[model samples]
Target chain A: MPVITYRQALNDALAEELERDGNVFLMGEEVAEYNGAYKITEGLWKRFGDKRVIDTPISEAGFIGLGVGAAMMGLRPVMELMFWSFAYVAYDQIINNAGCVRYMSGGLINCPLVIRGPANGGTNVGATHSHTPENFLANTPGLKVVCPATPADAKGLMKAAIRDNDPVCVMENTLLYGDQGEVPEGDYVIPIGVADVKREGTDVSLIAHGRAVLTCLAAAHRLHEEFNISAEVVDLRSIRPLDEQTVLDSVRKTHRAVLVDENKPFCGVSSQIATMIQEHAFDDLDAPVQRVCSLDAPAIYSPALETQQLPTADRIIQKVLAIS
Target chain B: MSVTRAEKPKKTGKNPVDYAKAPINADLTPEQKLGFLADMLRIRRFEQASLKLYQQGKMGGFLHLYIGQESVAVGTLALMGENDHAITAYRDHGHALVVGMSMNECMAELLGKATGCSKGKGGSMHFFAPDKNFWGGHGIVAGQTPLGLGIAFALKYKGLKGCCLTYLGDGAVNQGVFHESLNIAALWDVPVVYIIENNQYSMGTSLARSSAIKSCLAERATGYDMDWDIVNGENLYEVRAKTWDAMQRAHEKCRPAILEIDTYRYYGHSVADANAKKYRKPEEIEFYKQNHDPITLWENRLKEEGIADEAVIKKLDDAAKKEAAASVQFAEDSPFPELESVFDDIYYEVDMGTESGKTGRHFFND
Candidate 1:
């Protein structure tokens, strides 16, 4: 295993998959020649040539729907959006076509497509540019949504989503792109819908996904060092095919839970997890399931306000203290 | 810098370009000619029967009947090679039938029976036959535009000589996605023919009120530098000839084009469109039925061309009526989908029993 940035891990995964399967191609804005807006697809266009790494006009609706159509025709298409927020213009393509085509076609058609982009709000980009739509995407039954909190998970999940025979949406964080972690080189896939317990604990469970997982890990460390609360950190890597058993098992052992997410509070991912906890693990809980979500408002444009708006370790720790 | 003046689109009357102008139908054998007539008759009968069932309350949901525009699908689809693909919007029963979907499955789909093409899932608005290179009957207005472009992109990607017939209505041309699709189609030279089934009205809004055009809907292709033509769709031969040229440009040159098929609908946009009769004059509807009926026009052509006698025309029509009636009976006899099937077809992995499917709880209740 070698330490690598989350961006490099994703780039490696994309390059390896493109090399492994001739059908796999990358198509998006500035993916080729420009080497991607974020450079995640750096060197892919040069390595795979124009056919394999296609560049498109800034038409999210056109390219995304094209990817769905290509996938329907048995060619795997990896569509990239500069930002996940831009996907709003292409909602009909994402939700109606890519998400519902398989069900609409009654299993006669499958869109083996992967739509990946940075879907975070901490970059101080305005509300329109920064949208965390993992919950919105996961709400559709046919779509598979993943959030890679670590470099290893980013690499493995990208590989898995590319190989999977369904449309998978990989929600990456621009803030976490530079974060480094141990990622094994070559082909390996962390199966979708699996949770990784980042750290083991006994007193309370701090569950989260995406960048909030890192916040939970930091809070878990501080709690053990300062508050003497041994907090367990659970990273829900996949959102749709959620690893419910792992979540419940961790909650059962800890006897308390605090759900953390970057999504807004109303009908958010944490809200769903809280309901799941209350419904299934009611007896196992020593205290009610609590949530530390992004403030219930549009993403703030001010850097400082946006930082406070998102779930921080301090917020997670406060929620943990209240529950523990 | 000197700027070149934009070329104006050719202005034409209700019958713009005639079947006599193209004459691609000259090579067709009498049997093939009769087959075209038969195809139009099948669609007309199918739509007529479905409307009756929808009226009877046996079929629920919006039924977008393809009554008057039979020749557009039957004629244009006749030119498709094995590599050619077709996708259309909600008025899709015509394209589905033209591309070889059985009336039984389509009728069952309408009636929400398990034996339907989409296993009772997609109702009347969504029908698909991938094997026939018929991608789908997309429900969204111009949502299928890009998918059609993608199909062409895949064909060119695989080094195959194929093109996609992406059909949209005049109303769909106004959608942002269609313009985006047009831009990409021109930029990439994807083999896609955007066939605008300009049946005058989109829902209750007439074309004049819905779309602002210089000459025809296809004239919008000028902005994208794509080739385009307007064709009178009432004549099956005219549609076949003009569409054949566009499809050739796509298949041979890997170029995109827009072909506006001037046609009309006898009924409302959908069965639920309560003001279908109120929005348009009864005289206008009667005028179309009396003069511009696609099936009637094709049948007259078949007889005038010495391809089929009156008896043969009657036989083909009778057979079509029988097939449509039998499809209704089959739909009535078919069972509804199992309750558990509601969870099926949501994911390819889950249905195929992949490792991801076996390991996790995909459905919420599960």
Candidate 2:
């Protein structure tokens, strides 16, 4: 098994899927020649050629809808959105058509399209490029949203999305692209709606996803070494079809739960999970569900303000200690 | 990409209704002309009943009346075949009825009934039937244009022989998607028929207020390197004649065509405003209904062509109304869809794309 960075994993998955399915192709601005702004699609243009790896005009709504109509005719398309903030431009197509078509058409048509690109804060891409859409998308019933902090998950999801007959929004954090991990060599698939327990303990359970999942894992180590508090860390991989059983199972054993997310405090994905614990497993909890999240402010270009807007490892460790 | 119209050599005779004036052939026969007029009447009556329901609150949302603009949809839709696709603006009940959706299904959609085209979830402004290749009763002013070309591209890629007719109001011409789709369609020769249903009003606004150029939407075709034609929509014969020429040329040349049909709106923007009548003048409304009545002209032509007598024409008219009434009754008798089906049809399957997340399917129970 070759160890690949998260970025290469995404690229390999895209290339392999293109090679796997003739009907699947990649199209977006700079996706072909520029190898994606994040280099997640490097060298794909040369391999797939212009027809399969298309470089479109900076018209997201137009191209997104084109993907939709093409998908209705059995073409699976993977579109690289420039940034998470710029998603507003394709809101009409994404919110109205790509996401809504399957339900609106009542199963007659399946929009097997994928929207993939950078999400969350990294290298100060500014407020426009940085966005955490877990809450905005989690509420939408027609869409399935997932953000992977590791490359293996990114590669596995993109390929799976291409094969599935639905429109998927794969939120890729630009910061996570450099992450290197052991990835299976051949056609290996990672099952969705399953959580990976990075650290095992009994005192408390830390539930987190995306970039925050790593923070929680690091926080778990600090609590074990310094505070002598044992904490189990769970990477809540899928945000939409949340693994309630895994979450509750950990909480049931630990008697406490700590949720973390890079999204803002109000109505964040962590807030939803906290609510779920209270609603589904209220009697099993010993302490109230604790959450570590960013301040409720639009991401600014200033590095300090930007850093202040994200959930830090220290904050996750402090939250875990407080609940302990 | 412009056309000179080779229809003049076909015939030279009296206009069907008037024996004194000689008619010049322009790609349409008197019988075809009559057909366009009857088609317009069908849309007119179909939407007229829709407006009545809107008044009674049986129909929901903005019920756009095609009372004065019947000729435009009737004219263009008459030019389509089995494979051609049409995507239109919110002013779309007329388009749906003329595109061959049952009067009941279209009206039931208006009434928000289960038997409606969208099973009542789409209401009036979102009816779509892929089987018939009609993409919408889309509510957004200019949203459907690009999607229309998308469907055209799908057809082209599938190697199906047909062009896509994307219709929008004068208001929609200002949108970026309209221009985006137009530019790409022209660049690729995507076999699309871009029709601007310039009904003189985009809701309450006039063409002079909205568009920089008031003459013809087809004139914009030159900038995109595409061909264009302007027709008097109220004159169904002229509309039919022009549409026939454009559709054939679009197919044969493997290019895009823009047809600007200049028509009028007799009622207010929606059902609530119809009685108010503050936006338009009585004389302007009276003129289109009296001089340019598509239905009356077609009936007169049917008599002149000796196709049928007065009784036969009346029978067709009565049967159309009866058909509409029966469908409306069917919709009224039907029940609303159950609420539990709301979570159905989200996707094909969860495990298929099981890498990132598990997706559930949400289908027809809506």
Candidate 3:
């Protein structure tokens, strides 16, 4: 194991996959000569050369659709949306062309495409650039959505998405780009639909994903030190092919649950998780499942207001206290 | 059979210029020319049968007929190599038939039968034959343009000397995605030929009302620095002449081109368009039917070139009619897809029972 930043982990996974498969190529804006908009693809262009690592014009709709077409033709294309919010211009291509191609073609076509980029709001990029669309993308049946909360999950999930035979969307966080964690050396891949219990506890379960996972971990530590509430932190690494069993097991053990997420409160991923908990594990609960989500407003530009807008350790602790 | 125009022959999308005198490929054999006629007739006859069934309530959803634009598909697809591909908008029966989809599968698909090309998931507007290099019958206008560009990008990536002929309609040219596709195709020099089948009307709106351009729709390609031209889609020989040249530039130089084939549609935009005849006059439809009908033009050319006679043409038409009729019977005999199949094909890993599929529940209900 080696300690590395999430950015380095993602770059290493991409470089390894590019060397492993000839059909796997990277295409996006500023991914080649500019390294990357976020610098996640720093040295891939010089390593894989211009042919394998392609730089697309500022045409999200065109390039995303092109990636779907190429994937249908048996080439695995990892398309980068400079900002996940920019995906709105290409929403039709993502939802219809990439999501429905396989189902529409009735097993004759396979869109083995991966659309990955930073989808977070903590950087004060304004309301437009900050969008957590994991819920929106996972709503489509043909698409697989994942949000890696750590450096290890980032590397493993990126590799798995590239190897999957279906369209997978990797939702990354810019806030956690420089965060350091242990990453396995080689050929490591996390399955598309699995959850990781970040810490084990007995009193209550704190469920979260992406940056919210870190928030839950911080909340868990404070809850243990101050309130003596042993909070189990469940990191939902994959969203679509959701690991219901793991989530249900954690709730069934802890008996109380609090969901933390950066997505908006209305009809967010937590809404689905709450319904699932109430329906399947209602009898196992000692209290009602509570949620701490981003306020139902657009991501504000003000740094002070924006930090309060997203889920934080204080918010998670408060939600856990109410539930436990 | 000629009728005089009441006005100065309304400035419609149809180009009155005739390129039939343009020389076709020298290597094109007489049998190949006859095959072209057969392919066009097959599409026309298949569409006629599908329309009759649609009117009879045998099919569900929409049916967009490709009755008058047969030559655009046949002549262009006739020039495709083993690696070349074709994709089009919702009006896709012509491209599907030209790309070797069996009439039985296509008809059954329209009828929502299990034996259909898409196993009854995709109806008339979503036929696909990846084995034959036909990408799809995309529903959204201009949605397939970028997909076609990507297919060409893949071919170039694999070092294959082939091009993708991306087809869109007059209405589709107004969509923003089509422009985006054109810019990328030219910027990357991907081997793609965007064939704008300008059928005069975009649903109820005419091209003159929907698209604003100086001379022709393909002229917009100049903005992207891409080579482009307009060809008469009525004459099969001329369609081949122009499309052949564009295909060559794509294959040899790996460049992109735009060929706007001046064509017309005889029926409404779809079967559901109740005012198909109300928007346009009867004289306008009759004029194109008599003078520029793709089938009639190709049959006349075959006779003039001594490639076929009246009897030969009648025999080909009879066989096509018979084939279309048999397809109807096959569709009638087919079964609807099973309810469980509704969950199928959503994910390849789920169907294959791979590690990811077996580990967790793909469907939410599970």
Candidate 4:
């Protein structure tokens, strides 16, 4: 085991994939000379040269479409969007072309592309710059959306995504990039659509993914330390192929559940998870399922308003206490 | 009485008429001439049958006929190598046919039969044959422009001696993605030829009403610092000549170019819109049908070159009509897909060993 930051894990995955397959290339604005806007692709241009690690103009529709088209021709392209919100500029390319090309082509073509970037709202980057589009992207039938909460999962899921024979969106949080976690040394990959139980408990199950997983884990710890209550934390790393069995089994054991997510409450991931709990493990639940999500409003720019808009550990704790 | 102020001077350089023209390949043989004529006729007949099928309520969804814009697809696609890729807007049946997609598959797709090129999942607007390097029949206006640039990037990335022929309509030139794609294609020198099929209309509105500058769509390439040429799309010889020059630059120099083909569409935008007469007069449609029809133009050229006579032309036309009828039969006879197949091909499967010590693969249904 080796300790590394989440950003390093991502870089390692990209470097390894580019080295492992000549067909795999990385392209995005500022990815080559600027070392990536977030510095996730630092030093990769020097290692792989200009052909593999490409710098593109600030045109999301142009580059993303290029990735989709290239993927149709049997080349694997890893495209990066500076901000997930900017995906609106290329929404047709992602949703219509990248997502449906395979199914539309009757499987004659496979868009083996990985579009990865930060997609969280808590950095005070305002409404346009911040977005958690997992719900929007996951709603698409042909796309696989993965949101990793740790360094190990980030590295493993990114590698899996690049190798997967379909378009996959890797949603990374800017806040979690510098966080350190234990990652395996080399040649390790964690399969997408698998849930990991960070802490086992019997009182209630706190289920989450991405940055919200960290919030759930903190709330679970607080519940145990403050009230002598046990809580199970389930991390759903993949959004599309949701590991429903793991979620149901955890809820059945705990008999109480709280779904935490950073996205808005209306039709968000937490709403979906709460529905799953009520549908599958309703009889086993000791209390009604609770959902802790961001308030139903566009993300405000003020620091206090932004914090109030997002879900926090206190909110999760409050939801668990009320349900339990 | 009112007095008017002096008018400001009109700006220059907005429209450049002195565009470059490519010479026709001098040694085009009789065999090539006949082949070109046959390809154009096949497209014309196929579209004619497709229109009739839609009218008979056999085919559903939007039916966009490439009735008059045959030579643009036939001439441009004729020059592509086996590995070269192509993508276009919704008016795509002609391009698909010229790229070697079977008339039966194209008709089946238009009829929404499971035996279609896209397995019937995608209707007329989504035809694709990746095996043959035909990318798609995208429905969105100007949506295929960026995808075309991406295909060109792939060709360059793989060091392939092939270019991507991305076709858009005159109306698509106004889209932001089209400008962005052209800029990047030139900056990166991606091997792509941006072909604007100037059929004079974007759906119901004419190009003059929709576009700000309507004279030379190829001149827009100047902003991207790219080479561009305009050709008479109705004449197969001019289209082939100009496209050959563009493809040569793409393959040999790894450069991108824009080609504007002056063409027309005889029918309404789609079969559902029978009000084509509301936008453009019937007389104008008849004029293009009689004077600028690509199929008739090519047929006349073949006869004038002493390569094909009236009998030979009649034989080719009869064969095309017969093939179009057979394609309809193929589409009508083909069965709809199984109910379970709705979940198939959504996501390709990959084996991922499970935590329970069993091998499992990820797919749509499972």
Clash pairs detected, candidate 4: A66-B150
Question: If you superpose only chain B onto the true chain B, what TM-score does each candidate give?
Answer: 0.94, 0.84, 0.94, 0.89
True contacts kept of 1: 0.80
Better TM-score candidate (2, 4): 4
Models sorted by TM-score, best on top: 1, 3, 4, 2
Error of 2 at B47 (Å): 2.2
Best by lDDT: 3
- Report how far residue A1 has shifted in candidate 2, in Å: 2.3
- Per-residue error (Å), model 1, residue A269: 0.7
lDDT of 4 at B216: 75
State the lDDT of candidate 1 residue by residue for A179-269, as single tens digits.
Answer: 9999997787999999899999999998999999999999999999999999999999999889999999999999999999999999899
Better-scoring candidate (TM-score), 1 or 4: 1
Clashing pairs in 2: A6-A151, B125-B137, B344-B362, B344-B363, B345-B361, B345-B362, B345-B363, B346-B361, B346-B362
lDDT of 4 at A170: 97
TM-score of each: 0.97, 0.90, 0.97, 0.94
lDDT of 3 by residue, B1-366 (tens): 111222223434244644555555566788998999899999999999999999999889899999999999999997888989999989999999998999999999999999999999999999999999999999999999999999999999999999999999988888888899999999989999999998889899886678677247887888898998777788677788889888889999998998888788999999999899988997999999988898998888789889999999889999999999999999999999999999999999999988978756678873
Tens-digit lDDT track of model 4 for B151-214:
9888888878989999999989999999999999999899999999988888898877987776
Fraction of the true interface contacts (Cα pairs closer than 8 Å across chains) found in each model: 0.80, 0.39, 0.76, 0.67
- Give interface RMSD, per candidate: 1.0, 3.9, 1.0, 3.0
